[model samples]
Target: MKVLTANRLTNGEAVWLAGDHSWAVTLQAAEVALDEATEEKLARAGTAALLKNEVVDVALIDVELDSGALRPVRLRERIRAAGPTNRRDLGKQAELQIAVAA
Candidate 1:
């Protein structure tokens, strides 16, 4: 599977593209693309968002269902989904179960 992701231009916060076509703050809310059509659609949306200056570093990442939850395939993506590592209280993105890759 895949998930669309980017950094919100305003705040540089990692965000996921939701099924409803909205940008979500957490990975759990991201829309998973299980097929090529959905992936293409997501890619278009990401491109539009980028052109509108809504986000940056748009990309699709590979992912898998881990214990019934979304898990990013790459270490960098895992870190992004988990939020900052320095502190647990600030900008922490809930539990790992709550939230990617293209």
Candidate 2:
């Protein structure tokens, strides 16, 4: 994804595109720069990431066609941000339950 993450020119916060045509403020301190076309690709990717809750770095925030609307935030800097789901963890728990049942 081509996220165009940058400090908001006005508020100095990190913002990126999210799912449902919404924007999310990231907790990172990275600047994402890109051209007009690159911004579009990033935005689209950001939207997908949000819905999936995919783990993404603030710098990796894809800036899409409407990159201008996103604002960067300070919170985007948090390390090890998990995605929307933890399949492995869930599978482990399920395995334990099955073991008990058996």
Candidate 3:
């Protein structure tokens, strides 16, 4: 499967394209495309956001549903999904943990 990802222009936060055509901060909310044609269509739609400076580094990435959870297939994409590896208490992982704790 494929998913669209980008960094929010205002905060540089990693975001995924949701089913509603809105950007989501969590991968779980991402809209997954099962074929290359759908991937290309989503990528094309993302171009407008890029041109508007609403996001940057927009691209499609390979992923799979592992144990009912969506996961990036490559190392680079994994890092992007999890946030900076050097700091465990930072970024998306940390934010998610905090949310769960709450």
Tens-place lDDT digits, model 1, residues 1-75? 999999999999899999998999888899999999999999999999999999999999999999999999998
Q: Model 2: how far is 86 from its true place, Å?
A: 33
Candidate 2 segments exceeding 4 Å error = 1-31, 55-102
Best model per lDDT = 3
Which digits, one per residue and each the tens of the lDDT, describe model 3 over residues 31-53? 99998888887898799889988
Our model 3 lands, by Cα RMSD against the true structure, at 1.1
Q: What tens digits encode model 2's per-residue C-alpha lDDT throughout 13-61?
A: 4454443333445422223445666566665665555556543432454
Ordered from best to worst lDDT, the candidate numbers read: 3, 1, 2
Q: Which clashing pairs does model 3 show? A: none
Better candidate by lDDT, 1 or 2 = 1
* lDDT score for candidate 3 against the true structure: 0.91
lDDT of 2 at 65: 32
> Given candidate 1, what's the lDDT at residue 19?
93
**Best TM-score among the predictions, by candidate number:** 3
Per-model root-mean-square deviation over C-alphas = 5.3, 13.7, 1.1
Candidate 2 TM-score to native: 0.26
lDDT, each prediction: 0.89, 0.41, 0.91
Angstrom error of the Cα, residue 80, model 2: value is 14
Candidate 3 at 93: error in angstroms? 0.4
Deviation in angstroms for 9 in model 1?
Answer: 0.4
